[model samples]
Target: MPDYKHFPLADTAEGLTEAEIIDWKVKPGDEVTVNQIVVEVETAKAAVELPIPWAGVVTELLVEPGQTVEVGTPILTVDVDPQGAAAVNGSGSAASAVSAETTETAEAAEADADEMKPLVGYGSKTTVAKRRARKSQATPAAPAPEPVQAVTVVAPRPASEQAAPAGYVPLAKPPVRKLAKELGIDLRTVAGSAEGGVITREDVRRAADGTAETASAAPQPVTAEYDPATRERRVPIRGVRKATANAMVGSAFTAPHVTEFLTIDVTPMMELRQKLKGAPQFSGVKLTPLVIAAKAVCLAARRTPDVNAVWDESSGEIVYKDYVHLGIAAATPRGLVVPKVRDADRKSLAELAGDIGELTAVARDGKTPPEAMLNGTFTITNVGVFGVDTGTPIINPGESAILALGAIRDMPWVVDGELAVRKVMQLSLSFDHRVIDGQQGSQFLADVGELLADPAVAITY
Candidate 1:
């Protein structure tokens, strides 16, 4: 009998534990070539195309698209050998023997295709098992997933009192939980007032205020100890999330991040934006402060080319790129992604707006290709969309700086040495100190601020 080997999920370059099958390029019964992309998997970081290492017909698809698979799971099966037709009188002709030999050769080639890489601590070479590896493949004795902690928004009752029957701990976001922990409040002791039995940040604050009652409940012993889950979410980190995570981590630690803030009176720019709204060219396009900020960054890059260069560790030099690949930080359902606009410096205002719109649309739809997410020269993150005033944005890896555009609101400002009301906004620039010094960074930021303060300055730039 010929060996029918199953193709297990391999370790993608990124160390991801599980990946969701976004799409399957090949189907059952399809003859696949070695190293051919057969499936697209989405990790938390990005979506990557998985290539088949063996050449054979796909006998069975073990998992369907949108299904998550753990690393080392057998995703599909391929039959290396097909049965030869029955011979008359139990006798085979000369041509049949030759054809069987050819089939044997093909089967042999298929078997030879998948050469298992050795696992450490094993005394001898062991081939990967034909069956899919369980979630506990690495450590078989691990326990199941832990139960979710319940949140109670009401205050702790007297020593003898107990919680309401339906008062279970509520679910809250990680950041909200962090806040509660910082305030030294137990999540379970507080009664969740948010939707769907979820704990809100406000609920935690209300508990801290000492005015809220603990939903007629006593302080119960913390019985929930989190268990080590054998169940893992293995994502083949290949796409935008993967790229963005790598970039953010690299930029955060390596870059001596020095963020400088400048609050500007943008009353004139707002007037200009309003005037441009009536123009025929600005029709149908979303005219926001982000568009102006993008143009500003482009103008600033022209003034300071060093801001748009990558630090080449291998060459021990900085590689200054002539063209600008402006990365716009977009938050999608999957994760944070920075898709670039190629030659953004050369594009007209309308063209840049159109490209930015299209890039964001594609990224949100999860249709943006892998290559478009790479090789960014600089990044712009608009925190204003989230109603944030300012943030020290991390530089995207390979780039020297990132500009954060803050919320634009009407505020009291000193105009011509007098306190007056104006449309005030802030610009926060985070730069890699290794490449950009305080003076250079300040200049670049000032140039950007100037452009935003006066839109007509872009014509000269």
Candidate 2:
């Protein structure tokens, strides 16, 4: 009579359909409290820690680490009343708990809603439950597993889809089955490299490529010590990396990009930075060229409002904004994330530097929230930190423009008609041609260059 509750996976971010389990904070037999961090999941935007809402003893972890599951799928089971007399008598069945949970899901499905919403919870939900397909590999000699409902990820297609001869079902995961179907590779003909003769996605791909060894349509014992999985390291593209790739691809293909470069002597800006570092007001603030460039972009945007506008395809209009949500492109070990500083134009130089420091630190730790990454009007990516010269940057989809700040090199520049070695940096501005005119783009670049070339010029703006 253990009061067990099957805890389903909840949507961690907006429009998030699925997440990959990174790690579990607790296991079976461990005690947990309400709102205690239970698992780490990698969503499309970031890595997030999810907390359990129900306090209980961890009975079972249904999902394994590195496995991706759609939102609302049950991930863990908790015995809510673990100390109950019936629970202590060891009468509670996890299978019974699953049956009850599945019943609840079936009841919810009978509702009027056609399109299911992801049960929201990482910050805000329960689930749209879909019972996972079971792993249908047969092992007549092996002992039967316990009668607990387990998340089965290995089988998706029925035996009829595998083209096997006379009552044979190929062992393959859902993704592998889909891949095999697309590539027209018969899973029954391909030899599985995985343990228990389970075919992998790579095996199906190799068979399609003609690189896999041809074997008779018969199951064979895996005798070789070498694991084909170890032949190459496969990093699953999930979280930020996957989202960034998709976003960049969309931006690059959808928007007509025009890039303009401007190289300027930042000797004046550097000198001002040094002087400000000594000032009491600027104490503890690490003001770099990028900070000045950000400020310059804000000031310049006032003169060229088109750079801070969005080209709305649905509305067929150019949407102008009075405020700037400046996106600072931060590169973490995971991938590139452009988290925005809300109302960046209104912030002072010192405020901008501090906000960026905290924002980037959170991003580097892979903790930037989904809302922090949205609603950016303009983006500034400091490639200079990587010691890279300027390259054309892609517009951040909805926004019109992006600025790439390059390395600050000590180069010879003509100063007052005299050649002098000074700190010079290049700025590359890429804009959506549909939103920003060539003249406006040039004017914005010139304004930013002028501000960096002479710090006093900001008084006029």
Candidate 3:
């Protein structure tokens, strides 16, 4: 018998450095064909199904669900046989034999095996990273076709006879799938109302909304493995989350930070905002203080370029950026993420507002691409939305400074030697102490303040 070789993880769709394994469609020794959806991966962008690249027996699952693996991490192994015998004899009883003696191991080891079986080091149990590439014979076989079943419904049929009428399609719609997920309903057991016994979206919705019970009958729970709880449940950090955790730890420990704060009267900016609300170009756009604040930061960055520079510790150099890739801190379903807007300084006020609106919408929907979150030159976090008045914000790694804009509210101000009501806001700027001196930080904050205080000055610059 010829000894086989190991296959390292390949770059799945672009150069996405990492992905979390969401679910495995195949296990060790399962025979799979080409283009068959073998695994589900959650990249930073969306949940995607990974089709098998080659036809063969699934030798092993390299990565476990929940682990955030780098782009080139070996996700699984396949025993490809250009000769064809391996697909038939090699997978049949041999697979069943392996399954009979299932190995129970430590969770970490199990996770390693599930994600990617690590290359074992000499005289040690620890797994070691290896080089990445693809095998010439790694192309998988064709997928099996769906079997057709026939159904006959008549008066007083057996329950199982009523169960799967020959060729009965699962009665459910996409929205019903979404609702079923939320309400813990099983659609497979629910009978359909559409032609040819196909399930309609309304059928699933009715069952999920508990309104179907008022009509004909409620669906009995399908004992099929499609348990809503089993479909998805939280797994504490193994896949993408673990990978993100490691990267964050690495960035945090390597970067040093410093922060400063300033209070300013933003009555003028507010007035300008009200005026923009009536503008033809800015019509239908959601113009908020953050939009103006973004503009102020961009304008201020033009005068003070150091605030937008990225510190490259590897090269022992400070990089002064010519363009602003403004990062907006957004809270997402997965975690806290900062997605950047490219060339933010060049965008018009209305364009900036639109881009901000779209990017925020994408982030909230958990559909933001990984590339959108990369290469940020500066970051602004709006704590005001959460009703936070002031906070010392931690600088986003690589970028020299992070600006925290607090709630703009009414406060007493001195005007012409008399107290007057005014709209005021607290701004906190945190920077890398090694890069930004206290004077530079203070001046930057003041520049931002001046723009917000008198919006007209922005035109002069």
Candidate 4:
């Protein structure tokens, strides 16, 4: 007879009610040690790995990959002692007798293990059948979702899923990566035929059948061939994309938005950027216009603290933050993610540039930790990379303001009372009208533009 214990899903972060099981590291009958990583799950924020609380032989995996379950639901079960195998193998009958006698010890250890870890509001440790019975009685079963379309872009893999020295992160989308994992194919060995070396569903299928293609050929488009009769594709709104949609809707509707625009001659800024590129101190650092803008936002916030503040709606108070936690909006394969650069006001220009570059990289790889996405005071979205002048950017939920940076280009400008081809750019700042007055918003935008127009003006701040 085996003594078993259930492992329930725990809240990995604040206010996260549910998570989708991404993949399992262990299956039935596999031996797992205490605090061993057992499964990976994707919540509203980011992907997280969960550890088993007890050392035991895994008796059953209650959940399957891709299934979304509420927090506190048991996802795994383990037999704490299957005929005292550890006692039998390690220290003979004396240890074996101890193992049998210490069943209560095993239970105590599991409880202590969970208490040591920071899993907020752990789910109930009940049998799976009871959970199903209660859930089914609460509501009528809904119709099944349409199969989600495979994304064309690649997603970064976890370290355990990687191969070789410190692991190689393959460039394949989530669906494609799942397929490769199921087929027992090594993604690193397969040459991607898609644009920018991204692996496709077809590529994975070919690799599975030993007929993959080379990287030299032109990238072929992934056909929407799932249903020829319908001639349509459907993607289920879940995970990051789903969360983004809800946040945007809530922010757009709730916030009293006011956008102000400014056109500036940033020839001096571009000149300064060129000069700094050759400097040893700025070596290997990305000193883009965004970096300069980031610094300007920090400096401008000192004059007007409203932009670096949030609305505490629940408490009916407008909170002003003394420190700046700057967020850079990044568009990733999954969705829009605004990861913060902590204490932006305290960092030098080079340090700010490095932090932004690193944040962008991790975000694009879909590896941004949940902690990175929280507590942002202000945000700067550089829409210039997409080659547009400027648009009204919605303020992030809870934050007071957002700035959109437009493309920098050679435009005809009256420089020093004369017409000249100067490096010009447009700035659009959107702020919550309730928190920021028109005068304050305009002044902050002006300060940012003035600093960019004359890099020397940063010292005056």
Model 4, 269-363: lDDT tens digits are 99999999888878888899999999999999999998988788899999999999999999988789999999999999999999999999999
Q: Write the per-residue lDDT of candidate 2 for residues 304-365, one digit (tens) a residue.
A: 99999999999899999999999999999879998998999999999998888888999999
Query: What is the TM-score of each predicted model, taking all chains together?
Result: 0.60, 0.72, 0.57, 0.69
lDDT assessment of candidate 2: 0.76
Model 4 segments beyond 4 Å from truth?
Answer: 1-5, 29-36, 51-57, 78-117, 120-226
Ranking of candidates on lDDT, top first: 2, 4, 1, 3
Regions of candidate 2 where Cα sits further than 4 Å from its true position: 85-234
Q: How close is candidate 3 to the true structure, as a TM-score?
A: 0.57
Using alpha carbons, what is the TM-score of model 4? 0.69
Candidate No. with top TM-score:
2
Per-residue C-alpha lDDT of model 3 across residues 331-385, encoded as one tens digit per residue = 7766667779899999999988999988898888766765677788988999998
lDDT, candidates in the order shown: 0.67, 0.76, 0.64, 0.75
- Model 1 agreement with the true structure over 310-344: per-residue lDDT tens digits: 78888999898999899998888778877899999
In candidate 3, position 445 carries an lDDT of 89
Looking at model 4, which ten-residue stretch has the lowest summed lDDT?
145-154
Error of model 2, residue 39, in angstroms:
1.1
